[model samples]
Target: MSKPKDYTLLVIDDELQVRRFTEVSLSPHGYEVHSAESGREGIELGTKLNPDAIILDLGLPDMDGLDVLSSLKSWYQGPIIVLSVRDDEDSIVAALDSGAHDYIRKPFHLGELLARLRLALRNNQANQTSPVYTSGNLSVDLSSRRVTVGEREIKLTVTEFELLKVLIRHRGKVLTHNQILTEVWGPKSVEHIQYLRVYVGHLRQKLEADINKPRLILTEPGVGYRLQNLDLLKEGMTASEAALIAEKVD
Candidate 1:
């Protein structure tokens, strides 16, 4: 029942016009807006204020937007929307892949921006309730961005963590190559199935007792992959064998 204006927003942009535009457009609508013209200042402000959300511009005077995003993500846990003139797929994917919740091309429509902000805020709030997910020995804390296996922490790249998160969220359900790709790497990278395979391989290596015979993640045999249900995996068949059985059923 809360409106976006009830929340605080930080805008990291160098262009005075963009900053003013954002302020003028959203201020009357109930948003508590703050602005910074450089990445360094933005990072400092973000760290200090801990706003409900951030709107970041890719082009900045002191540092690249990606750098700022990476730095902020190292500590900040909030919805970050990338607002940039770079509409190229590479830039967009890079931003989203870096940890941005959404990407908006510059010259953006106010309505669309508002809509995306609302959706991101809603998702953020929903995620705040359930931060930790567990499956037997493996545990992932979404809020802390930590993964562990029986008290030992597992190191994972941002991409790998994102991929694992998607799989774990849909445990016991098969997710096709495209579904995983789109969810983790953005829609532009959906055709890059090899990316998914490589990251999955990385996740297996880090989490599995033996990578060759994985006990947790299962390959769908020319289809996709699924995170094994610990209960079912212990009952009778391992996930790998279950996957083989599924292939047979299909």
Candidate 2:
């Protein structure tokens, strides 16, 4: 089996200690780690190295980290995980809304950072290659427009399926109310958060065994919603069985 370090990683933080610590830690794990201390330098290096993944800091010397993120995301197709001290909901939502794959607060655990990076990479790969998404007992065949829960098929209205499709395309990633509404409804409908909520509720009713405590369609509190990508629970489990396990864990 190939080791995890087969990929390249870029660490963009103004703190020399942070860059060094990340390099020392991830280099031992097989990753080719590179560092940049400023937003402009990070953008330049990111454009040049085209690393498989990025660890970005929100506080940069020359420019805001979010701006750098936007610049990199304009062309970079790989995952970008925001690693910063800003743990507030607004900052987190902004980074994710700007196309970040994941967010990690500063003073973070290295183990948790590694786990999030692995998931981001896995999800990125899966998104590119598969038209079918299976998590737990729920299955969505994007190419076929088919959805199933456990052994039984579930029916969805046109609008509801459109909403669900948006969620599936960005599975495991938070979709802001504006993002979801704009995609499923339209740019003009971005303010129609209520519409988005209703459709999401409709989806949960059909997809979740217990709508009161949903496992699949998750609320990201003040941000938006994320479709749970329970990849680990997907092995031979029925929809009902998956729900039961999820309920227990919840």
Candidate 3:
């Protein structure tokens, strides 16, 4: 589907005042805002309309916020930032685990929420599928959702695409299992390290010349994973010598 000219947002919260306030805050910034008074309505809107981002409140009349987040994650690729009055550790952790990209407790400054939205948009640019970059033999198009490795287009699942995006975002930064899990799968996913291992292995099989000992997606044993183009990091090269690596993901 062709993306709309403006960034579109879906705000899901049972509180009328909160939903209205968020809509007011975001609309002026050139975002097309949509609102839902309950979790069920929000889910329907999210599934039917491919909005650029979502702002969901955990305490909904129809369902728990974490459940809403998890259900949406199976289908959406764009960011979903959670808003709620509950700030308990478990609640926060669950929201993240359910696939929320970011969170803000109730009584948050509208400005701060706006800033977080901007960051999510900045990050979503990678998922745009535009013809973006090439490293070695891989060609990535963020805007078109097309990838070509050695002149052949590669097919990837939603989860695989998202996994690839997370690795590319931290290109040189060695992302620990927990950090990667939270960022890619949500905070509640800290214990699912095996899921990470399996997907990383899949990525290696698809991208590496030899899957047994990978090159592009480097594993750090007990630490985490670092993804970098090996040619850009030959011996004696400074970290600064690493080329600006890029990947198209959403």
TM-score of each: 0.56, 0.86, 0.55
Predicted candidate 3 versus true structure: per-residue lDDT over 1-250, tens digit per residue: 6344478899999998997887777777778889999889999999988799999999898898888898899989888988889877667656654657766678877665665566566545633543465556876666676777897888888888788877766444345677788888898998999999999988877888889766678765454676654433443233332321111110
Model 1: lowest-lDDT 10 consecutive positions: 241-250
**Alpha-carbon lDDT, every model:** 0.78, 0.83, 0.72
> Could you give candidate 2's per-residue lDDT for residues 1-250 as a string of tens digits?
7456688999999999999999998787678999999999999999899999999999998999999999999999999999999989899889988998777777876666666666577777778987989987899998889999999999989999888989888876667887888888889997788788888899989999899988788887777887777774353335555554344224
| Residue 130, candidate 2: alpha-carbon lDDT | 79
Flag regions of model 3 displaced more than 4 Å: 1-5, 127-250
Model 3 Cα shift for residue 67 (angstroms): 1.2
> Against the true structure, candidate 3 has what lDDT?
0.72
Residue-pair clashes per candidate: 1, 1, 12
Candidate order (TM-score): 2, 1, 3
Question: Candidate 3 at residue 2, lDDT?
Answer: 38
- Please give the TM-score that candidate 1 achieves against the real structure: 0.56
